[model samples]
Target: MNLFKMLRCAFLLMPALFCYSQTSSGSTAVVSLEICSNESSVDLFTMLNADAVAGGVWSPSLSGGQGIFNPAVDNEGTYLYTVTTNYVTLYEVEVEVSVVDPIAATTTSTTLCSNAGPVDLIGFTNDTSNQGTWVPELSSGTSVFNPSVDEPGIYSYIASGACGTTVSEVYVEVIDTANSGISTSLSICEGSSPFNLFDALEGSPDLGGTWSPPLRNGSGYFDPQRDAPGVYSYTVGNDYCGYSSASVTVSIDQSPFAGSDAVADLCVNNGPVDLYAFLGDGPDAGGSWSPALSGGSGWFDPLTDQEGVYTYTISNGSCGMDTATVEVRLIDTNNQPNVSLAITDLSGNNSIHVQIPNRTNYHYSLDNINYQSSNSFTNLSGGKYTVYIREIEGCGFFHKEVVLLGGPKFFTPNGDGINDYWSLFDISNIDYTIKVFDRYGRPIDTFDNHSIGWDGTFNGNPLPSADYWFLVNFEDGTTKNGHFTLLR
Candidate 1:
């Protein structure tokens, strides 16, 4: 072929081939996104290089060689893009954009109050890139849903945005009104026993309240006498059939709610103590004592009363009752009477009377065989005697020996173990003045501290054994004369 002719032909084929290349192999892009169905993506052509593309026009006026996509065509379809480089010739490209209805695409559950307002379904819209529309035009094209009008149930809506159009249905539940009151229990007077726990419900539609700390009769009732008084827990379902728990206090009518039992102490042979003095003197405050007694009025006779412990039930009609015990103590005087005798000229008194403890009836006796009422022995001879006394009551008789010491009688200093020294051994424990004489009374030496002596001596010299007369004076200005043998 000639060069000029071939060049002309080559020049003629270049435009068609260039147009075909431009039409067939236009640049393409694939975009993916997830956005709320009520929103849309930016213009698609801005993502492509439109200025570098050899294109005359956009078929949709919104498309180009590297097309600008319109979410307005929210359905999946092939979009045509073209441009005229050489006049009268067209280069075409296809932008296959697949739009989706993301409406109903979301699976979500919702909870709502029956008194709620407009609900927004946009939060449940799965695809957020595509610009779509919502169904049930209550929101028109607005993706906001209204639960007030739409009601509470599974409802569907369509949303369009930049990502895609989708249909979504979500569960909506309405909480119905139930019993909203604070509590459901009851309290009643303790005097009124055997009252039903459920019967005391106030402001409650459901009256069936159950109780813990059940009644003593094994029933659902409250008994002051049978059931214990305290805080009782109860559980009652609301009007919605849901349960709530609470408590109430039951009490008795008494000054000291805690009852104290009575207690008493009685001496043996003593009359019974008046029960009213220990117990309250009220119609409500009464006592019941078992095993009847006999004694002075309002008193129990300990001597005649039963030997066992006596129990009294102290009762109050409103406060209930308690018990008390009285313990009886018996005294004994049967032991020997404690007695002592002192020789004295003062006040006509000669004997000391022993005082017995816890004893009521007492008697005394001077003579060993005969009992007397007088405790003192007056003007009696100074001698060894016996005291016999007994209580007129249960106490028995007692005997004690009494020794009366006068001026010292004859004492022998004969070196015998018995009465060895001419001393007043009986009055040795007392203070006295004693003098000695050789048959002719003389104050040889006044003795006070020591009474062990007179060894039949005169001025430190051994004297013949003889009867020596002695003068003794006591503390009470009373003088006595006696004789002592000083045999050696």
Candidate 2:
């Protein structure tokens, strides 16, 4: 070292080399230093004043005159360096050493979602010294950790005090939160085909989530025919966050089924009948009828209703509606026939002709099963008969009971037991108004069905034997007008 000082003295002409040699000329300097206990040994010469010279010996004698200060081994106090010539002190400097135990390097861990806001990386550690710098530098060029932009890992926070640098490890784990996507609603027909429920979601959803109230097959597929319609939920989770859930509302619509068409027969005078009774099979209820009725119901009134095709309709929202038709026909029971039969009963030509206004519009039948277009029906003998008259246009049929009187053509009212009175045959209990007129059509007699036969007399006087015309008026607006002979 002495030889080195002599070389520095030879270069005194260079001011940069010989300017700091003023310490050898009896100069005093002092300095204070705070160093970390874990730091490397510091140079005592560097801590001294800039004008201080080298080749100084420390009071706490360092080996080899190195002027090194080690905080780990040295105590916290003032360290003195002295320079002497011939054992007389020429320069002296004080170095106050402060040993600051490394800010207690902490190991901390923090978990955050990638969507979390920015935070100070050093805040996770217990160290209150805000002088930490992150390793691989924070992307924001600051100590604030932005989880969205910065990569997450073990970040070493190097904090520096006046002492030295301390390393803190921040185990940062930035994870993505579970996303179950957006909630939505869907409506499908009850018998619709199967489809994936995940596809029905609104936004971009995370996959591999479980469905609540699990589907029939334990999958995201929704089968309208098999699955019960209601709300379903999708849940996703991890160890970090508990869980996240979203719902999908599924609504099933019922299909509309209208029954088969039918034909009905109604009587004009039979009042109203329910049109639903005419449907074929299991028809859906609560339907509407076309050609709206006055009563707003399915009842059809033969008196005031139109006869055609009536339609029934059943509706089901977006699934559309179904329709069926009911054909209606009306029968006319009005204007029933009142007939007058001319029978040649005594001569054995027992033939009767039906009399009606419009014979063309009616068909005649003695037995209801057999019908004929002709109004005349003939046979040998007759007592009582039922005449059936049906409309040719499929309206309806009408039947009437009539007595074919088979009595003598000429009646002798001579008070004898054999031919005592002239009256209708086989009509003892029938009620009728009988009028006997002479050849000039004069009124003669009137009797009821409960009375005895006519005595062939006018005003208690015996009438002369002659051809007289008798008219029978029935209660049902039918009249039997014919000629009969009366003998005195």
Candidate 3:
């Protein structure tokens, strides 16, 4: 050993390096330890106050001059030390040591069912000095250290400890035990009030629950009228457990019309109108027709359908349905009249009488060319005349030729049921005169009116077979003259 080296071992009581240099003035040397294990040896010679040393030993050490201050052993309290120097000044090196583990982490997390209740983060930490706190505090400090309700995710915990604050991460994973039993989809009528999805969830946690893309009522209720149709998500968390999520689907269904009533009018002979044509838009359009049908489905057929009231119903989805009531009526206009004639005696007049029901809307005319409001014609000659009947209300008219009763010129008075008398069939109450003459235009037999007709004879006796001439006057202002043959 060198002379100085030998002297350093003899004076120092602990393991360390001793260096000595002969000089009039002394200089200081600073030593530093950048990295170290849990417990490590610190060099005492490198931290000497001066390069020149006579002899020295550190106090508080039994057999070593090495000063040791480990964060693990002494905690965070201070440990004082002093070194006595046998030379001009004391050769001492002051050092501070800390034991900070790079990766020392105990699970600061605990788990619970979503409904289990608040989690105590303080109880979960193994670190003696500090209580753990959750980062990104839930709902802004509402669930900071509480598990009662928290957002579900990987949460970090920082526990202040004696050996340099160590970070312990706690993984809180929440299970949907409460909401798993409930249904996720629901339906509501359109234009209706919003329904709350939270109300449907079973056993769900009351706290730490949040809805995404919130609704007007703050995310829980679904309004079909104002909200867009889509799926919504809900998340619930507890401090003890992480978090759970569920989806809800909001479906809007169409509603039926409030009321449908219709009325219509058809000409007496017109038709059955198509019921669906009058019905406009509705919830359930193109619906089925009731009461069965023929070739025309959903149509009203005038030929087969009777004139009456009817109904159409629109059946919506499932049991929803709407009914429409319809009323139908008809307008009638037609006149059919009965015609009769009355004959008068001597005056050769015939009265034409027309019988019509409800004369209020009817008019009659004896001549087809002209029309009159009267229903009777008087003093008409023996001839066929066309009569016109008109109903003015509906602008409908009828025309027909009427035959007037006239006397036959000749007849066989021999009786045997053959042309035994000269008579007129359709005689009226008007005056009429018939004169039967011989070959010469002399008057022989006379007849007047519908009460009597001339037999082919002079007085009451039968006439011989010969040609006869006759002159008859009608009740009207006209007369009839004719000739005929009499056989005996």
Candidate 4:
């Protein structure tokens, strides 16, 4: 066939086919194609230049001039379609084919706290790219998620490519942080009954919180007698979002104890005594006394202060107050005893008896120190005596003074050893003058206290036995007149 008729027949059969003579410049038309791996095969002629002719064969050929780009079997390179007349190349076109494999979609899940900052959504997946777009738009405008302002739910990431479209899901969950409320303090007296710890917390707190260290009675109630006073904590939330805590400081107060009542005795003769000495054991200190003392102290003086009941009080803010009483008594030592004495004899072994209406209540003492219960004293010698009496209850002491005179009844002067001489009894230490007279009022003998008495004689002559009268003058300006028998 002629070339003109041959070209005309080719154009009617294949529209993309074209013819060129030996005189035409030889240049190849180019076309590029990017297709997914999963795409179906297509004819190479359809991908070539519309001005190109058919009856052409593709290099790296396919059946029926079809171009198949499979990621598993085909390589990314140029596939050429050529048209030649009589085996000489006339028109040619190149088709560049690229194969892309679809990306695998990913899914991830994460939990964040509501207080957390912004986070990039792309970081949640490894197989997904930053080019992906979120299904639901974020408040941050970009792929970043702000937990504080954003709602938590499943977010879809759509990534498109020549291979196909893929989807990735980021399941985000936001949890609210726990709030245990504010802390406070409270104080209550010791031994107080059931106290709830909830009353100590300040502000409106979240519910479903648990207490730490457990309350004394197991119910959140504090027993003052059993529970130790200290800090108590309340915690809320779980490990997912972390926990929150608050505290209550509990203080247990004790009542002031002044101890039991007491009694004390004070003597006027003694110095001041401490009133606290009479109080019961383990009395509370820092207490105040009612009917205030002289120096505002615990010392009491019976000589200057009146005797009555003194009360001690101790107080505190939480425990209120407490009190105890002390009864004080005063003793006077100035009361003298009314006493009477009975004397037995003036000479030799004599006895002085003392009598009092209330003798049992008083103690008797010859020497003021050594005392006895008995008032009668038997064994005695002639001397000046002072008797003392003291009250048994430490009241007072009284004394009386007396002088006892001692003498003999009579004496015999017949040269007998028993009655050879005579003198005034118990007057050896006394200075006196004596004059002796006969029964007829005649002067028989004279002597003084220093001389022996007359032995029934007058002027060196023996006189008959008779009763003699004597007048004695003592140095103390006292005179004694007595009669004595001088027997021969």
**For residues 292-321, what per-residue lDDT tens digits would candidate 2 score against the true structure?**
875679988877788889999998874789
The worst-scoring run of ten residues by lDDT in candidate 1 lies at: 2-11
* Model 1 bad stretches (over 4 Å): 1-95, 101-420, 426-429, 437-445, 459-469, 476-483
Choose the strongest candidate by lDDT.
2
Q: Which run of 10 residues does model 3 get worst, by summed lDDT?
A: 2-11
Backbone clash total, candidate 3: 34
Question: Best TM-score goes to which candidate?
Answer: 2
lDDT of 4 by residue, 1-488 (tens): 22211111122221122222221223655565555556555454655544668787778875433554444466767887787999899878676666545666789998998888899998876444588788798998778999988899999988765455688899999988887779998888896777888767887766778888898678778888988889989888888888989998999888788889988876676567777767788777888988888767877877677899999888865678899988988776866666888876444567778878778888898887688999877757654578887778786777886544455556777775787665666655567777788778888777886786767778888877777787777777766667777776
How well does model 4 score by local distance difference test? 0.73
> What local distance difference test score does each model get?
0.51, 0.74, 0.55, 0.73
State how far residue 182 of model 4 sits from its true place (Å).
13
lDDT per residue as tens, model 3, 284-341:
5666555644434656665566556566666545237667755655555454455343
State how far residue 236 of model 3 sits from its true place (Å).
Answer: 2.2
Candidates 2 and 3, the one with greater TM-score: 2
Q: How many residue pairs clash (N, CA or C atoms closer than 3 angstroms) in each of the candidate models, in the order given?
A: 36, 0, 34, 6
lDDT: which is higher, 1 or 2? 2
Give me the runs in candidate 4 sitting further than 4 Å from their true place.
1-122, 125-188, 196-213, 226-254, 259-286, 290-297, 304-309, 315-318, 325-335, 339-355, 363-488
Model 2 residue runs over 4 Å out of place are: 1-32, 35-43, 46-65, 68-109, 112-122, 125-188, 195-209, 229-233, 236-239, 244-253, 263-270, 329-394, 397-488
